[model samples]
Target: MDTKRISYLYDRYQSNSLTALELEELGMLANSQEFDSHFEVVFNKIWEELKHEEVHKMGIEAEQAQVDFILSHPRPKTRRLKFIHKIVAAAAVLIVVFAAGLFYRSFQSAQTMQPAYAIVPGKQGATLTLASGKQIKLSDASKGKLANEAGIEIIKSADGSLIYQIKDAGTGTSGMFNTLTTAKGETYQVRLPDGTVVQLNADSKLSYATSLNAAGERRVELIGEGYFDVAKDKAHPFIVKTATQQIQVLGTHFNINAYADENVTRTTLLEGSVKVFSAGTQKMLVPGEQASTRENQLSISKADLESAVAWKNGEFVFTGQPIDEIMRLLSRWYNVEVEFKGPPTKEEFEGTAFKEKDITEVLELLELTGAVHFKIEGRKIIVTK
Candidate 1:
């Protein structure tokens, strides 16, 4: 492909102005050896634009959506570019997925035989509990308007995520509250009335008011893990309350891991500032900093932000985490039981993998690392050194 055409396509992809057919054409071009031969040019263009930050998270995510759509649908034709598009789509996915911390499968070495039974990956969905204590399964909810609660309109978008809009700001003060919960092997995203977006991972729950309270504090209680992109409202601090601490932010993006089974609760700030209050102490965190709390005691330190927000961004990022920790996460997403063959080993691994891929792929990757091996029998995964 000519640089002029490729450059234009890349610009359109970045700006998200590309038509459906144009995106397919771009995906096809990106999957081509000809395009691969000149990847340096486009790669450099992207790096030049987004060198200081993560390169095109929105754009890459859009590309991922396209690739996923293409894969799930039947092929159109067997043209040269079409065949190349299918083959290169995986390669193209690696580029963007790796940027977001998903382990690229192409880099793995030869794999040993996987388990007899393979486990499919998790999908995007959750359950919503209204103030009346009625439960609405998001998967069962159709597209468009789902409900009107406390003057807040709840809609399930075409992409399967939930959106909330305020029908009347005057009615926003209602005491009615709603909750979103994700069961094991499921994940979801929902926008709150204040425009804050929350992505819930497997086995997580977020409870928030139908609208802002009279106290001027937009607070939400979280159990398990979730990522937040808070809309700016300095007058009303967006407070994320967990079992261990309260993270107060004024329009920021962050990730919090508050799972009960974990030893400590972690809050990682990605952008903007957050004040963490716990254990009778308060500390402010900047971008790339994390607050870890156990009991009432809290500590501040630099953290792996990528790993922190990996689940929200659709990947499993292990930053030198122990095998036991890894299995705990896998257990939630795969909805399976994990058993150790013997004593726990002191091995750590640093890598990433797509959360929506087969569980066998991850186990086999670990197996290849000489760290551990795995066997599957029904819904149980046995790990051995």
Candidate 2:
């Protein structure tokens, strides 16, 4: 039967009015990726219809539910349509996994996964640009007052963290700004004037005013990824400004991934609450929720918190990422060049690897999956199918 016919049969099944013959016919389509995707859309609508809650988890449960309900057919003494193939039901039920598991499928295809040379991983160190334009290499700079900007003392702690203290509150200019930046293969941690701790990922920047505004708002602009543990100030809300979105919070722990190259800017909240807004959309996120902003629209969804914060805690949660997206992240964190011989691997991958491990070790894990192969030459990685 044509896809339209299959779709019609599936619709009837979803509405709880399908015959056993149609059920077997539709089950055969489960092995088809295109058909599965179509079924995913159909089941998403059914989940919404269920009205138990938003279809936040994987969408497979709905598919399995239909199968289970059909198998539990209770009408006795009724002439049942005999199925031609019993295996169809089992295969269809197994295919009912949700999108959350999209990138985590069992690997079906394999290739060599080796790299030419190892690249050093990024570490906790960044450069600080004071309001006076004086540069301090935070990695090499010793503890103590590194510089002063607008009356705020820029202190480099012995522990390699940067801090801004209002040494002479009445003497410093309140509106001046300072910037903290991490280069490729680097990271940084800093405390703002109000004691908010920020953890910056590789190739990121954070710019903020040295003092809170008189209007009672703590504002900072982010250009890459950063995790924020905001200090409580009910009277002064903390706002993280990105190019296309703004996240406002009273006191919360959140992570913002606002890389310029990414089409969607993501804000994942881990603690308390946060409000994300753009041109015409706004969303308030609770713990374990994430907001993705693209093209002036903001969408909310349940997030894999462990994956979202993995980098901040020194690991990479490689789940369902294609070769291209995977290389881009490695390029930033390891400061290396990457080229692909063919189209990037579209398969999803999973594993937890340390960020501090040699880049080769990380690539080894990817190779073990047989998803793709990597060859490095003079710091350049060539990806092959």
Candidate 3:
């Protein structure tokens, strides 16, 4: 009835490495209503971990085969087990079946011909362009003060974050400006001089004045996706400008996706309030609301805050998003090219992947959906139905 032992046995069973004694112990525990609560908690935890590790999805045919195998296997007869215990036992069997299916697919993959290619994931890196047009590759810069301009010190923190600290408040308001850009396969975080913090996604850019309030307003121009936690400054409202819209806030936490390739610009508010303006139209957004601008028109709706800011939290969350759009995101983060062999499928994907995983693992997870397959050649990924 020990939770840890139950978890260990479950894992071993999934991997097909459980010994006869352990299997018997797990089966006995599964038939007992005394540990029904423990079993439920462990079941949920294991399911989440499997999904997080990108091994939850499997082909329908393979899953059905595993289910058949499970049904044919002998089970100990139990008359006193409660209904809840029966459900728990059934759920545990399903988890083991899926895990077996995943293992079978992995073995099949390994038996196939191997390729000579690999693509890694993105990491923390950016290019900082000072007001004087001097570019600093932040990835190569040491952890210390990189530059001093107009009484503001630009330092790379020990954790690889870009920080702007004021050396002299009197001289902080210079007319100079700076820009931070992240190339493909890179992301970066910055603490601006005005105490605001921003996390830039891959293939993005942010331009702002060194003092942040030089133009009588704290404004920044964004070229791609970015998460902003604006510092509270009643005297100077924070403004974020994109190609299609501008967001104004006194202080708020929000995420903006305005990639040039994307058709619409989406701004999701997480805390406080923000006013989004585009083409003479504007909408005020409360927390958990999203404002989307397309073709000079603006609209508001409920927001999926977790999916909106997943990248900033080192995750890739997809909620019924098309494969093409998903490929676009992977292309940026993996610094690779994607080609469709023929007509693209209309299938959509719904799952969560860690941004830190390699491109191959993610592709394998997607392949489990059976809606698409992939072939990697050098840095290119070819998609096919």
Candidate 4:
């Protein structure tokens, strides 16, 4: 495998100017394990030309797409290579280089037509409102005890996570509640008094009693999305209330997506059991099951756990999700407004992207599918066919 030839084919493919013969040749070369070392050298050279900042903007989805394209290339039926399995195994390592080459080419092209505005990804932060109506901006608050309410002491850890430490367990009920809210482009995690941990996604809120055991049962009202890890206390069950549904559990790990813009409230159980109540209907969900509630109707299905908690894990994992839904998510995380300029392209996107990438890079990854396009003007993202 000639490194120069490999580089030429890669450049042509990136420019969409590769001929049929060249495409086949490139595919064959990419399919061979013997040429993997040569591909690495060529790609490394290309990667060197990318600016340091641009290299950081590259995304995993783009790399995965390149790998998929290379692997899907038709093999020569008449010839069987003994190292075919080895080539398949090495594709992941090699394709990263190929993807970097693609990103470098894309970065060069982007420079010629850069958008007027760039939207950075979301960050870990939220606002904590105490029972007395005092609001503490967690993002700006120092790393130490922020407040003391009733018997709970609110502390901000070194890593920025909010913590509620019990000062006097017997001090009990104060008939007061505290709320934690994350605005657009922000997220947060908090450890409650009862040892339960709650992670709030962007554009979400969680309100709970200052003392978890004060009400006899641990109760919390949630808006938008949250991942809950309830502490076990058989005497006092954990309960989460959303707009359309209520989930009661002894001690469980689960996620609830109850955005008002969405039609249904989804409760996905990752561990233990939960009973979802909606209107007058109720359904018990086991692990790996999801309960969706809308009005008086409630249904259950196998849950996509990874997708359910992707935000909490700092990634966006879309599996055949529509363009509108994807943009809705992007709007929340990037703190941007989305407007569709034409009839929506019915394209379904499937990929995993890090939430840290700039909106431009994410949009570019989606555009690679040739299904949708985006334009940024100030804080607005205009979608087009």
| Top TM-score hit | 4
TM per candidate comes to 0.70, 0.69, 0.74, 0.75
Q: Could you tell which candidate, 2 or 3, scores higher by lDDT? A: 3
List clashing residue pairs in candidate 1.
103-352, 103-353, 279-296
lDDT of 3 by residue, 1-385 (tens): 6888877876786576877787667666766665556756676676555444333354434544654665566423211111112333344454543433332343233223124755789999999999989999999999999999888899999999999998876776657889999999999999999899999999999999887887567999999999999999988999999999999999989999999999989999999999999879888999999999888888899999889999988888887788889999999999999999998778767767788877876786676555677877778888888
Error of 1 at 173 (Å): 4.6
For candidate 1, give the lDDT of residue 325. Answer: 88
lDDT tens digits, residue span 1-385, model 4? 6889988987897576888788668767766776657867875665444323343355545654655765577422221111112323233434543544443333333343246756789999999999999999999999999998898899999999999999988775748899999999999999999899999999999999898776579899999999999999999999999999999999999999999998878999999999999978889999999999876688999999999999988788887788899899999999999999988877677777788878876776665454566777788888887
User: Which stretches in model 2 have alpha-carbon errors above 4 Å?
Assistant: 1-118
Off by over 4 Å in 1: 1-117
Off by over 4 Å in 3: 1-117, 172-174
Local distance difference test scores for all models:
0.76, 0.73, 0.80, 0.80
In terms of TM-score, how similar is model 3 to the real structure?
A: 0.74
By summed lDDT, the worst window of 10 consecutive residues in model 4 runs over 76-85
TM-score between candidate 4 and the true structure: 0.75
TM-score computed on alpha carbons, candidate 2? 0.69
Instruction: Evaluate model 1: give its lDDT.
Output: 0.76
Q: What is the per-residue lDDT of model 2 for residues 1-385, given as tens digits with 9 covering 90 to 100? A: 2656755875575465767676556555655667655656655555444434333245546656765664465423221121112333323433333332321221111112224444689887898887777788988888898887666778888788888787766665546678899998999999888889999999999998777553578899999999999999888899999998899998889999999988888899999999998867788899999998888788899988988998998888765666687788999899998999988866766556677877876774465444577777778888887
At residue 85, candidate 1 shows an lDDT of 23
- lDDT at 381, model 4: 84
Candidate 3 scores a C-alpha RMSD against the true structure in Å of 11.1
